[model samples]
Target: MSKIKTKFTERIGIDMPILGFSHSTDVTAALTKAGGMGVYGIAHDPPDKVQARIDAVRGQIGSRPFGIDIMMPKGMPESETLESVQAKLPQANLEFVEGIAKKYKVPEATTKTFYNTVLRSPSYFEGQLQVLLSSDVDLVAFGVGLTPDAVGRLKAVGKIVGALIGSPHHFDAYRDIGLDFIVAQGSEAGAHTGTIGTMVLVPEIVQMAGDLPVLAAGGIGHGSQIAAALAMGAQGVWLGTSWLATSEHAQGDHAIGDRLRGKLFAAGSGDTRITRGSSGKPQRQIRSAWTEEWASPDAPEPLKMPYQHALVGDLMTAIEEHEVDPLLHSPAGQGVTWSLELRSVAQVFQALSDQTIAGLDLVNSISKSP
Candidate 1:
């Protein structure tokens, strides 16, 4: 198939207009091989291992222009230790976590779980940033906190930098920063997201972006959704949730157990809920006993960021370690409905590309009608 030419694709030098972001390097590499731009989300990696991880992913995607995604929030703790965050845990929170653990019989994690590996502090973020600045990454798209200084640093290193924005108000800052691109992620997106729907958010950001390229995200898992984004004036589409269902993800480094994957495979659009339970942020993820417990009246008021993650980190790690199917869940968008059943990266990419072309043809036919 011929390349899908868009302003963003042309500028970024990719054959496809789709930009795939995932926490798994396997999915990242596979997306690149499948023709889209793959952006590896390394927020979970230990700071010291960032470079090695980048190298591994680069090795797989050989010579392809891939990117990395990180959460760079402003005003985070400069140097907080895990013990310090643990010390702040209230007795009530501890008891609540214990109760859940007891109910599920989750065992103590034998090895270091990803929860303990994540240190939401400035030092960790900076460590990763420094490594990326000198790595082979082609683009940097950051979410969560707004960091203006990092933009200059990334550009200084000759890397294309972009930010994921949920609102139109965020456009000016990126435009002023001369960001290479902007991704307007809507509320329907999995994980941390804003309240605006993609339909409204994409056009607003596109209008604000003007000549700057815009990639529409959130609740976008199919070719028609990509087509819709293009129609909204976006130059391309940025996808995160779609990659979660790919076969590469299931077999990746941090892949979930068969039970959890089964849950995701069978999930419907209504199976997701937005809650601050997992990360102290409003994250839209698949509904599970964990999320349901948080929604219950017995649940305590969730803590803020960093603290919230610290509070539940152990239990989340335990749930995954034990394969507690009832409690296990992952961040996913409403678009998960369309991506039901695991497919290979190549197959998913081809389907989306074909659908996008067909959708464009349909739109063109309708426009020329009497």
Candidate 2:
């Protein structure tokens, strides 16, 4: 009955061409209940926590189809231990984090055990995948990269598998590898992304994918952008930053929620920067003292994947405990300029749908005028 239906939406049983990618189960459930699909990001959590989060979402949304996103590094070292990884971290990087703590006057962090178990071994990664396979989730999405064997395994279990790719080369490589869909993430997207902007990247990926449905991501925060993506041949839009300012975000601490909401509201289109300093990958996050300091000439070069993540794990916790605004940062896309208000998930879905319809109507009217 909706004009926005696409093969992707039909396959997933959602009414609209929107997918909310969030870390919060509440956000995921709310988006699904509102007619768009929600993709729970389970990359950071341990297996037990991941299962619990999935169970909670399943309980809330009933049988509505939902998906899970995970990080799958293409190239991991043959062997790595937490202690060995820590040993390799440069002293300058440690000094830099300490200097930031001292400058912010942040107190010592609470003795909380941070989980890096998944990064410690390949078996841990397999364990996380096993948890998803055993669950009732309708779809599984992988970022960074996924192996053909993994894709085959998920497909064999009747789980729809999708992957995020930035270039046509990557898409071509995986297109025949049994992917049900592809998310074309651009440079303007939050988290780990490549250097291509959406306008150029989407159409290219759509053409390259041929029959495989493509979802456009990056710089898409409003209905007009959705309309643009559809015109560019994207089956749907994959959104991240737009949901951070929504009411359903999992900011348990009221102070932290308020701080994040305020920063998102205050940020303009140009306030974000792409840097490998935070995650050891090119992630677009709101510019802050942490990002700026990392860019300084005296700063140490960031380590690779799991190592960089491990190095900052405890430090980020300490900063969060202290509520250091300058040091606090979240991956936010260039679309953040549109996130100037904290609205409910339902309101956001409605707004995007209405705007998309209006945009389509305008195009129809113009095409018929002369």
Candidate 3:
């Protein structure tokens, strides 16, 4: 029997329907080389750093296809002058953040350093997009704060515009604005995700998306899950947490990687807490001192999207620079446990695709009926 082709497979110029997520340059290039799309998250990086990362991926992958993931939640767009954004931030919030910094034993200079740099801006997506376009990105996917104008501009360039949404209702919003595809990300997805789990989210989004392809995300790592998604009518799968453990994901420091791997094996289900500790929105992160303090009643209510993330920006930098585990924040979904043993992006993508085909075959055989 011939292999089934998915709309996503054709649209993104990949042989497999996997969308590997990692901030790691190596993993992004490896996934593209291995026949699946590699999506790099650029929302958190400064413009210069983001450009360098894109350049690194291009240098590695050459003409192979890849995409960029920019997070746009309900907050500031980076387009505004950094000074303007800094002015808008409440003084009280900064004071509170500093208090926590002091309590965490974070150096005053370190706390000040975050505020001085890593300014918040979703609007900078266009600037980042412009950079990616100059490179070799095949698709540019936007999540959270996607604007109509940005969607139009991306499509005008003949680029595939994928908006990741938590609900089917938002699909209409994007469709109305002309998105090429909608990534129906369930709550199970890692990094800033919504409440609805993938099982119910994918079909709902597919139905609402009209002719646009819907890629199922959140909690999908294995072939059976991909097969289930395809059976339910999704055109492809966007796998993030699955790639965290891949050899390509050198993004995580040694401590972060150890904690992540430890979570997988010790499994009473790794601890999860919905905290406004990172990026402000109530995102799920592995339980840690920062998140725990933020969740505590004494801590001020996490600021809304931009404010929340802005408040903690310095701390994240500190964590990275110091290589501190407690300060290391990871965005993850329920499916992260399936990720173990770092392999190349190609290996992970092939495993997902091959398994999906096998799972689909098994289902079809059963359905062929006696």
TM-score of each: 0.96, 0.94, 0.86
- How do the residues 1-370 of candidate 1 rate in per-residue lDDT, one tens digit apiece? 7578987787788898999989888888888888888898888887787887788788997898899998977666767777887887899988988888898778876657658656588878888899988887999999876467888899999999988998877776567876888899999999998899999999998888888888999998889888888899999898988878778888757885678778778888888999898888899998999899899899898888888888888788878877886888999999888776778888999999999988888898885546
- Full ranking by TM-score: 1, 2, 3
Of 2 and 3, which scores higher on lDDT?
Answer: 2
**Predicted candidate 3 versus true structure: per-residue lDDT over 1-370, tens digit per residue:** 1244786688667776777767777877887787777888876565566777777888888788888887655556656654566567777777777776677676534443433465566545556666755655678888667777777777777777788888767765667887777788888777777788899998888887768888889878788999999898898888877776666565531223565555543322355566767776767665667677777787776677565656666666676555465555566667766666756666767777788889988997885545
Over the full model, what C-alpha lDDT does candidate 1 score relative to the true structure? 0.85
Model 2 lDDT, residue 128, Cα: 78
- Give lDDT: candidate 2, residue 153: 87
Question: How many clashes does the backbone of model 3 have?
Answer: 10
Q: Highest lDDT: which candidate?
A: 1
Model 2 weakest lDDT span, ten residues long = 111-120
- Candidate 2, 218-335: lDDT as tens digits: 9888898898899999999999888888887845311236776788899999999887776688889988887897888987888877777777767776766666778778889999
lDDT of each: 0.85, 0.83, 0.71
Q: How far off is residue 31 in model 3, in Å?
A: 0.8
Candidate 1 Cα deviation (angstroms), residue 113: 2.5
Give the poorly placed runs of model 1, Cα more than 4 Å off: 367-370
lDDT accuracy of residue 230 in candidate 2: 94
| Number of colliding residue pairs in each model | 0, 0, 10
